[model samples]
Each structure stands twice: as C-alpha cells, then as structure tokens.
Target chain A: MAQNKVLLKDIANSLGVSTTLVSIVLNGKAKQYRIGEEIAQKVIDAAMTMNYSPNLIARNLRGGKTQLIGLIVTDISNPFYSAIARIVENRANELGYTVVFSSSDEELKNTKKLIEILLSKGVDGLIIVPCDGSEEIIRELHENNTPTVLIDRNFPNSDISFSCLNNYRATELATQHLIEEGFENIALIGYKTRMNHILDRIKGYEDSMKKAGFEKYIHVKKVNILNPQAEVHSALDTLIKKKNADAVIFLTNMLTVAGLYSLNEMNIKIPNDIAVVGFNRNDLFNLFYSPITFIKQPLEIIATQAVNTLIEKIKNSELEIKSMVFSEPQLIIGASSKKV
Target chain B: MAQNKVLLKDIANSLGVSTTLVSIVLNGKAKQYRIGEEIAQKVIDAAMTMNYSPNLIARNLRGGKTQLIGLIVTDISNPFYSAIARIVENRANELGYTVVFSSSDEELKNTKKLIEILLSKGVDGLIIVPCDGSEEIIRELHENNTPTVLIDRNFPNSDISFSCLNNYRATELATQHLIEEGFENIALIGYKTRMNHILDRIKGYEDSMKKAGFEKYIHVKKVNILNPQAEVHSALDTLIKKKNADAVIFLTNMLTVAGLYSLNEMNIKIPNDIAVVGFNRNDLFNLFYSPITFIKQPLEIIATQAVNTLIEKIKNSELEIKSMVFSEPQLIIGASSKKV
Candidate 1:
C-alpha cells in the first residue's frame, strides 16, 4: 500500500541481476552465487528500507517447498520440553525456516493424527518429541525418508535419526547428589513409562545406588503421575509406608515439582525431612519457595545441535548417520538437597 | 494394515449412500442433509469400532475449509496465559477444528509478523492475544474480511470482534477481597505498557479504593517484569519505601509470580508484613509455597464463546456487529491474603 516499496523485481532491475539473485541477497545466501559482498549488501539494505517482503505464496508455489519446519512436542506445559521447543524454533528460524508448533497431550491417537497433519502442512523437516512408542509411525516416517531430528526424550529403536540428552548421566548425577546428602534409602517415584528417557533415568539411579553398595535398598515404583500432586502423594505414602525412603528422586520435572508441593502440604520439610532431585531443569526451580536441586538439561545446546543435524540431513539428502547428540548436563545443588 | 479398517467408502457402500452422506453423518450434520438417524448411528458405531478416520486433506479441499484455527498467545511459560491458550485450543478442537499455536513473547514486532505468517498459512480463522493497539494492522485484517476473534485482551478503537473477561470488575473484586481482609494500604504493581487489561485493572482498583474510602492510601507503579530479577527486587524496594502498603494487587500472573518470589527473597511474610492478590489463575497459585488468592478467568466459557463467534463470522461471511462478549470472572480464595 505504500509507494516506493521495493519489489523483488525492482532489486533485480537495479542490480542488473535476476529475481533469484535478489532473493538470495535478501536471504543472506548470495555468497553461494559468488555475488560481491558490496552488491549484496546494497540490495539487502534497499529491500529493508522499502519494507519489502517476498510473497510467500508465489515463492512457495514456484519452489514447491514451504521451507517450514514442524515441531511436534508431546506436552507443551512441561517446561523442559517447552525449553527445547523454543530452542529448536530459534535455531531453525536462524537457518531460514519458519516453524509450526503442535503438542500431542500424551494421547496415542493424537500423536498419529498430528504426524499426518504436520506432513500435509508441508514442513521441510520435523523435530519430534514422539508421543508414546508408536513404532509403526516412526517406521512410516522413516520409510518416507523425511528429514527429522528427535530430541529431549524419544522412542527406543525408533531407527529414525535423533539427538537426545544423556538421561542416564543426568540421573546418575542426581542419585550421587542424594547419596552425598546422606540419604541411603532413596525412592524412585515415577511412572513406568515405555519411553526410553524414563527407563534410562531408572537405570542410572539403580547403577549409582549399586555402586555405592546399597543395591538391596534400591526401590522403584511404576505409578501414574497424570495428576502430579495426587499421584505423588499416593506414591510417597506407599514409599514411606513400605521402604521408609529418606529422600526422593523424580524421573521427570512434573513429578519433582508435584512431589515437592505434596511434601510441603504434608509438612515434610525439604532436605531436613526428605531430600529431592529431578532430571529436568526450569526457571522456577531455583526460585521456588525453597530452592530445588535438579540436573538441568542443556536445552539450547541440544536444540542447536538438533537443528544443525537436521539441516545437514536436508542438505546432504543421502547422509545416513543415526547420530545421538548429547549436550553436557549440569547439576544444580540447592538447599532442597544440601547436606546437613 | 488392519483388515477390518473401515473407510468412508465402506460406510457409504454399507448404507447405500454417497461418501458425503457418511461424512455428514460423522460430523453430526446429517439432519441438515435429510439423512436418517438410524443410518447415522450405524455408520458412527462401525467407524468407531474399526478406528476409521477421514482423510482430512481431501475433505478440506472439498469442503472449501481447512477446519483449523490459529491461536497466537504472548507467552506459554506463564501458566495463566497458557491456561487461556489451552482453553481456546480445546474449544476449537471440540468444534472439529485443530489449533495451530504460536507465541510472540510480548514483542510488538513479532505480533504483526505472526499475523502475516498465520494469514499466509491459510488458517480458516484466528483468535489473537494482541500485544499492542495495532488497530491499523487489525484494520488491514478486517478490511480483508478475515475470520478473526480477539480474546482475553484487544486493541484500542480497532473495531476487532473479541471477547474479554471483565478486567475492571475482576480487579475490583480482588481489591475488595484485600480490604475485607483488613489491608488498608494497597499497591498495584505490573507492567507499565498501555495494555487494555492493565488499564482496566488500574481503573477497577481506583474504583474499589474510592468506594471503600481508601483512595488516599492507594499506591501504584508500572514495572517491566521481563527485566532482570534484580530490577524486580529494586521495584519492590521502591514500592515498600514509597507506599508502605500492606499488600500489592498484581494485575497479571507474571507480575504475581515474580512479586511472590521477590517478596519471599526479601523475607517478607504473607498477610503479615504484606498481603497479595493476583489475576489469571494457575495451578501453582493455590498450591504455591504460599497460597495466593487469584481472579480466575472462565477459560472454557471464553474459549467456547470465541470459537462460536469466529465460526459465526466464517459461516455468515459478513459479520454485522463488533461482538465484545464478556464472561464473568471468579475469585479463588487462598491462604495468602487471609487474616492471620
């Protein structure tokens, strides 16, 4: 609606270049065309000042690609998962892709539906936080050979390319922290989910306790934390009545926060009465009414790596490395799990 | 593939009807097409048992609609905002429309950018959580006659069809709650942005204090909560020094959580040295280390109303009036503001 608005055509004519050259200049990829930096910069500056935006519809139709990346996170309310979602979005946007986001709410039917929905949306690549273990869904996606990257937590034997956190290492650190805090009998209160991340956490906790010569006292429970506070209270009641665990290790952020709140409700003080630790990290952890100790995942690093890996797959097309990238985990010790 | 997998063609063939008849039956709109209920239920039961799903792409193209809604919220990390987003999403989905979501992170520029992106994505309708009074931007959309419904908050003089919680009345209820609990000196702390929600909150606080004859004791300050925590700490320090207010009514959830955490760090006890009431309820509010009273928006009602409103606009093509539907808000009593 504004006069002097620079069209892609104007840039091409002014620079004695093709519209494709102008597109490359505006996209910051003109270097691939051996275009001189000065000419490219001039074209870019003119386009910016003129408030020029490429007509996405025309471009998409011409290229037969939306250049959009889709991210299907299983649960958006979880901060750990959400942090990764934000990182993936930022990194993908940096590499010249717009992101479309969706969540499965942990429903198997919804997960399958979302995959199909995203596919029809015409995303160039996918970064999945797979819901449950839909082996067939992964197989279908793999068969289609869509460029994808899985992160944070993913399905086992998905056979699809993925990059995830070192779940076992994170849990080992949390378990060791609890041991050093003088808690011998620890309760692993969490869901017995088939998710690889959940199993990896348990293995890490069990291995650490065994190494400390306390294998007999190791207790694990398969319970629902759908409603964290209620389920956690029930699980804690069982753990306290049966094994009398002096501390708890939460396999997920949701469980950890819920357990802490339930403990506060029952007047069980942190560290003093029962110590606490969990696998995920969040902005609210340290800021809690009482500081919560947690093994924080490197969300940004993981997201960056996943994006880079997916882009590499897109570029190479024939790249076949099923690499699992891990960001070095950090252990945060707070008053909640501190030694007396 | 499962052998008994039912398809629309199967239902159509079994019923001696067209696939459109089966679709209309599945959509519960068969009555309009003069289809029999007995036939509809038979098709529905068979489809359910066989786990049959319609091919969405073909259906959308044929129906001349995508059956998808787009919701753009400011931030999802804050449970209060996410709660509203979730409400809109579920309501839209229940009406057979899936929601595609995006966040603006309170950036004015991103808000406009998102509008453009969603338009290009070809969502049938939109429910926007606008950051600023971009009436011109909203006007462009209105001029284009796009199906849109603004919810929770909206622009100034934009003539955008929207639904809003009665913010002024809600805040008045919160202020009255604090006063009834014997908090004489009150402070209103939140972002200084020219948000309609914030302005309404200030108006409500002013009205309640005047009605209760505590107008002279009212204190207020605009804050940037997204700033460093140190900035929040300093703002709290200033409020305490300037107002000596016994409580601060936070207009939004972000301010509420930040104030609570900041006050806790200052070693200020709730309902003793200070009391608090916040708007936009979240799970952590009542379950907080210190239970906090909050004004809860009727998210489901708002979501349902917004979807109905947008769908009405979509079906009718030309909307007659600018619908400003307002839902009544509720007050959740918590221990934070109770008399000690």
Candidate 2:
C-alpha cells in the first residue's frame, strides 16, 4: 500500500528531471517559470501515468482555492432537484470545479449543519436551495463573504444572488389558462410555507382568480412540505368533494405527483371530471393516463446561472454584482389541461 | 468579512478560557485531557454560538480523518441512482460522515477523473457505481487498500466488496412469470455492455426462455448505455414489428422507461398488444397509462449495506472483512404484465 503511493519525486526520477521542475509544471506554473511546453507536457504525461496527485490538504492549508464547491438541495431523491444537480455538476466540471452535494430534507437544522460542514471542508463556494426560515443563516454567509448563490428560491430584501423561476408568473399563467377554458371553480394545491417563492405562487393564483372575476370560486389546499403525501390526498379530497372544483393547479412537481396519485385513487377522470395543470414536468408525467400540462422551469439556464454566479463571486469577491436572474416560466399544453 | 471569521481564540476570549482549552474541547478530546466537564461545555457552547468551524484542511494535513466520503454514480438525474444516493447520504450522516457525490455519466474516463479528484480531496472512502469495463480501476483501488465498495453492479473474479441485487434471479423470475402467463415470444431489452450484471440479466432471460421450450422465440435488443432512447425506439420497433414478440422484459429502470416511451409513441397498447415488465420501480411508474409491473430491488437495504460496509472498511482497514452481499429482488405484479 505504501509503495503504491506515487509522489512528485517518483515522477521526477522516472522523467529524468529535477523534482522542483516537475512540481512547478504539475502545479500549473510552467509558463510562469518559463518552462518549455514540450518539457511540461512530458512531466504531465509521466505524472498521469504514475498516478501522482497533489496533496489537496496541503495546498488548501497553504491558503489556495480547493476548486471544490458544495451544493445544498432540499432532497436529492426528488427528480426536480436531481435534474438540477446533474446540470449544476456538468457546468461546475466545465469550470474545473468539483461539487459536493447534501440534502437538507427541508429542515433548517439540517441546512445549518450542512453549511457548517461544507464550510469546514474549505469549499471555495456554495450553491444552496435554502429551506424555510434560513434567512439568518444566509445573512451570516453573506456577512462572512462566503461565495453563495441561491437556487430555485430566493429571500426578499436580501443582497444575496440567486437563479430562480418567476414562480408568480408561472401560476398566474396556469390559473388564467384554466379560467379561459370556462372552468369557474379552480383550486390550487401548494405547500403550506412562509417561503417567498411558494407564497408568490399562491398569491399569483389568488390574484389571477380575482382578476377573472372568480374570487368567490377560488379555493386552495396547502399541504405540509415534508410529509405531504397523506396531506395531499386529504387536500385533494376536500377540494374535489367539498368544493366541487372542476379544475386544479398543482404548485410543485412533488405536489403534482401526489395529487395525481390521489386523483387516480379516487378514480377521477382528467379533463372530463377535473382538469389539471402541474407546476413542473417529470418524465413520469408522460406516462400518466392523461399526459399533464405543466409550467416548465428552464432548469439548464437556472443551474448554469447558479454555478456561473457563484464562481464569479468566488473569483471577484469585491465585484459587488448581487444579481437575481429569474427566467420566464413556460407553460406546456397537454391533455390534462385541455379545453373543458 | 474579516470580523466574522470566528476562531478558537475568539471563542476562548469570549468564554474567559485559554485557546488551548477551547481547541481541546472542540477536538473531542476534553475527557482524554482530563478537562472539567463544566469548562468543556462552556468552551463548546461558545464555539457553537460564535460559529467557530475548525479548518478541515489543516486537520487533514495533520493526518486526521476528514469525515468525508465520496459517492460516484452513473447519473444523479436517474431516479434509481438518486434514490440510492439519498439513502446512502442519510445513513452516512447518521454515522457522523458527510457524503460528496458525482456522476460518471456511464463513461470510464469520467469515472477515473472523479475517482482521482475524490482521492485528492482526502475522502475517507468511496462508494462507486462503476461504469462498464472498469475492472482494472477497481482492482487498483483494492490493491491500494482504499476503503471502497461497489454498489448496484459488481465485477466477477475480483475480491471487492459490493451491495447489489441478484440480477440473475431477478430476470429469471420475470421471464418465468411471463412464460407462465402463456406468452410465447418474449423479448428482453437491455444495454449493450460487457458488464457482468447486465450479462447476467440477459443470460437469465435466455436460460429461462430455453427452459420453457421457447428458444427460437427468445429475442434480445441491446441499446447503447449513454444514448439509449432513440436506439430503444428502433429496437422496440424491430422486436414488435419484425420479430412479433408478444411480451418484453426490460433489464433496468432506464431501459424500461425508454421502452415505455417508445411503446407510447408507437401507439401500442399494454398487455393486449404487448405485455411488459420493468426492472425497478419509480414513483413515475404509478402514473403509467397501464400501471407497470416491475422488479423492485431493496434499494434501502442495498444503500444502507453499502454505507455500513464502506464505513466499517474505513474504520477497520486491517480487519480483512471482504464480503459481497446480494439482496433478493422481488417482482411487483401490475396490469402491464398480466395473464395473456
């Protein structure tokens, strides 16, 4: 095991060069030291073949960037977060950064602990999907100048940067679409949260309904964020049976899926019995008995923006570019929300 | 930013104690050093309140464990992998370890690069879902005495630990069920790979077909691992149109989803036109036009076992417990694969 541990000296000895020369070239200072391209390439090839990797701990202790980033999401098991993670990883890799991911489980305690752990690991920066009431933690990160970029949601009245969807517009479009289809009673299934993004969506639905002169028929059933399935089932039951809602808009991918499951269990037909529109798309949506219409967030754009913004912050700490880029949400028409 | 950088010295000063005392308590050696419990608690509480996170880089350079593990999967966007990742992360967290994850995209080049990066970061161990033909890499990891455990797939004739499903028995059960349902022409959709796990599934299907006296009717369509959807569509076309296959078995979660998409595009009916069975379950499966029948691998068990074994190896490097555990796979009957 000890012999298998290759070192700079081994590469230098094999390549017939001084260990100092090999070290400079491998550390990406070849040009700064006026080393010839041919010689540098030779050293690099030897190092690769000998499996010589620089000690990241030593480099990090020397106050060098670790080239490592941390990504904190609510849950990796959720398809939406997983898709975003894939995109973020791809983007970060292209920028020569490795991302370490953690799921907060939508708990503030978990979020705080994960942030502390990531910080202790000396990550260059963080991209977080903040849970409810994490404003203080984010403010602390901001005060410490720890490069951070929020994704999916953002805190209002904060100087933090973010890449998110215009959630308000997304639900507004869905509610209006359902109303235009002559559905008087349209209900929205959303999470019961104080988070601005979800609150914006709920407000959008209510405002759109009021604008359409359907405020009297406006109904909403909010479900618990973490343990949502059973609550979603009961919520759907109340909305459909008690309110006799003819159409419903689900405010998130998970909620949409849960609502679909409940609707299937109740044997309610889509468009014929109760029209539906979901917040985001999953490939699973395609397999639904009635392919769902959804408001699609530009995941690639949001992920790329988050990584780029965080890297920018890391590279230029004093640049003072606190930008919040919200891409427009797109509504994908499908059989579930067809004319009724 | 400078003022917010909390240190052990700052905590010590705030709590009227020496920096050495604060450091000893925070390093979890207060009892070992015979420090009073009351004083240790005071020091720890000050550190927490002041947000004093120890520099992991310095600790790691001092030959201390980083309390970090790396997870490498084929793709985090794949629900199957994402689910396992979530479970592994939770289990590792419970054991006082943090997990950093990356995707290889099923490419050997990416897998090697990820392994190198993770190693350089001083991860205590690795849990990898190896890409195809990565036997030499796994062998090298074993020889290096790296605490590594393979998940989802395993290499034969190697003394590496792994937690995986019984691939052979899983497909055998699925094929036998289809045959018993009186389907003569049963086709298998799998990946075109030399990987043993995939080969085992194919062999299981072929052996089951020959044993049922339907040798000539046995058909197998292999799709490219990276770019599979289009190939899956063409493969399904050939199996259904040219080969007149009455039933099909998908070898993996992805292959099944791709096949279902193709069948939907081809406007083929499930069960009546072509019975189908998938390898694993996704919540998306519940929404299928005809609910999918699938083989459900015990994901929680596999993930928990992988974490436990890797942690055990990390803690006891010289313990010499090289074990490979394969859990049983259960078939979930659904309408998609009913009696013919």
Per-candidate TM-scores read 0.84, 0.91
Q: For residue B109, what is the lDDT in candidate 2?
A: 90
**Candidate 2 per-residue lDDT over residues B31-89, each given as its tens digit:** 99999999999887887777777777777878777889999999999999999999998
Best by TM-score: 2
Candidate maximizing DockQ: 2
Poorest stretch of ten by lDDT in candidate 1 chain A: A1-10
| Pairs that collide, model 1 | none
Task: Quote the lDDT for B11 in model 2.
Answer: 88
For each prediction, how big is the interface RMSD? Answer: 6.1, 1.9
lDDT of 2 at A308: 97
